[model samples]
Target: MAVHPGDSPVHVALRTSDVDEARAFCRKMFYGPLQVNPVGDPAGFAFAGDVVTLGSITVGEISYGADVRVNIADLETAYHVLAPLNGSLWSRHRGTVVIADPTRAAVYRPVGDIDLEWPGDTRLLSVKVERAALERELDAALDQQIVSPLLLGESFDLAEGRGRTWSALVRLLHTELCAEEGLASSPRMAARWRDMVVSGLALTVEHPYGDEPAGLQGPRRPRTVKRTLDAMHAEPWRQFTAADLAAVAGVGVRVLQEAFRQHVGVSPLAYLRRLRLDGVHAELSRSDPWQVNVSEVAYRWGFTHLGRFAGAYRARFGVSPSQTLRERR
Candidate 1:
């Protein structure tokens, strides 16, 4: 259903009878390049869309007045969710098919080929999140490096529990953003709202880490683990070997490794790499793109191999180092 014009401030509004114009608007505002074809009579085609953008997130209410088929080769740089407010949607992605209705939302990952069938009666509340932004939020919440692709389940439940909560939050965010002087008008508040939405999705959707217990406290750190962590945090720029960290903890390498495994989820070197990556991210976030180089920053954070570092960085943050550097603040 289209948002009432006077009720919410729409960043992009479309009410057109031309299919090409509707397709072009969808390309510009949401997905990149895609194809839209009417399933029935072309002469009966009508499209209505109302959208609001909040930083890396875009939420929209959209509908096609006639049945249509949409094909997208790949989303490329974002994750999308389509929750129908009424009627149903048929979607196929990565060999999986889902019929999405009000209780079920179709989730599309960045890497897949997608095909969708939209009946004339359906209207959708759609959410789009930039790949990097969502990945970064997942990393912070899990306190570890996330694997690439971050594969998500084809369908998300919106009838109860966390999924229902997240769905409500998305609608609230859309409404607030649509207001001319809502809470999201402030940059800081807007960021918090964006984080809440992404974080909610990450927690609600099924993924590789879905089974991990939430808020489970790890074992308390003993003195040796604490000492080693202090040393690493103090000089993350230092090129440290396992033996060196063991020496700093006043324990043998084997003993230190076991302690790290017990108290920390990762090994010592892995922890060091995480620390270094965090340092690089902080520097890139504050450094001016014109005055800084991503490689130099990587080196400064003790990332000796450029290729491996870039891969790890993208795996953890879901974007290239240069992209992060350029989009600083």
Candidate 2:
């Protein structure tokens, strides 16, 4: 997936029962160089294959003949990060253990040699995102090549048991994916699909180098920063202050402040506030105008103070809540 930051999305989906065909696609993508070391002899570990259909948002329609299992090294160098649409995968890379089962989500960087495996039967969706292009997409920490594997490196799983907001983000993407995917027709049919692809990619490939902790990508840890981040995520719109955060994290106010600065790249308040915006965006993105109330939507995301919320919401999203609600219909 050679990416141009502003370039649209390229989506590909494949299901193949033939190991040869699946392996071929993997080879074309990255597994060849990675040289997957299967646990047992191929004849022994191999399971029934799938009826494969390769779908694309870029490069158009490409057909595949069989189901495949593959292994590769230094994936971050080859493929751009493609967000996981469904299912689970187990992989190890970059001295980290990654277990991505979108329901729980496993994301890691394969800086060193890595091992990856696939489920006996799986349906996966991939969107090619070029790091070079992502630089143009936004000014996030992703401007540099993310060595963090799983998200972009060879292939890894999408873990499960994410915090509430992350879970909500998946629900939105899954909804759009199920509704418009089969009828996507062409690569660039509508912005909603593009938004779906981008949003999913951003949330899933979250790296710690920028503002998050070194491994805040998804493993369950009990550090104060981890607890603090999760707490803010749990209550994005809360009127949380630094002192309040320190109490939640069980650290001195200054210590927690420094930790947030070093790990998350932003102050605690800033992180929480941004998450609030994301929360609102997720709600608006998924809300059905015919069924949901607009003001109630704002209030739900902690926008009870109308004017301030409207201004902040408009500034963050480029569109007013009214416009967002109308479009949701």
Cα distance off (Å), candidate 2, residue 150: 12
Q: Which of the numbered candidates is closest to the native, going by highest TM-score?
A: 1
Tens-place lDDT digits, model 2, residues 224-261: 88788767767766777789999999989888878767
For each candidate, what TM-score against the reference?
Answer: 0.64, 0.41
lDDT (C-alpha, whole model) for all candidates = 0.80, 0.49
Task: Residues 1-329, candidate 1: write the lDDT tens digits.
Answer: 23222323347789999998999999988876789999968877889998887777889999998999999876768989999989999998755789999999999887657899999999999899889877776666553445445667788899988888999999888877867788865666777777789888887777643344133344345789879888887788899999999999999999999987766657899888977876786677567898989999999889889999999987765667887676543
- 237 in model 1: Cα distance from truth in Å? 28
- Where does candidate 1 clash, by residue pair? none
Write down the lDDT that model 2 would get: 0.49
Model 2, TM vs. native: 0.41
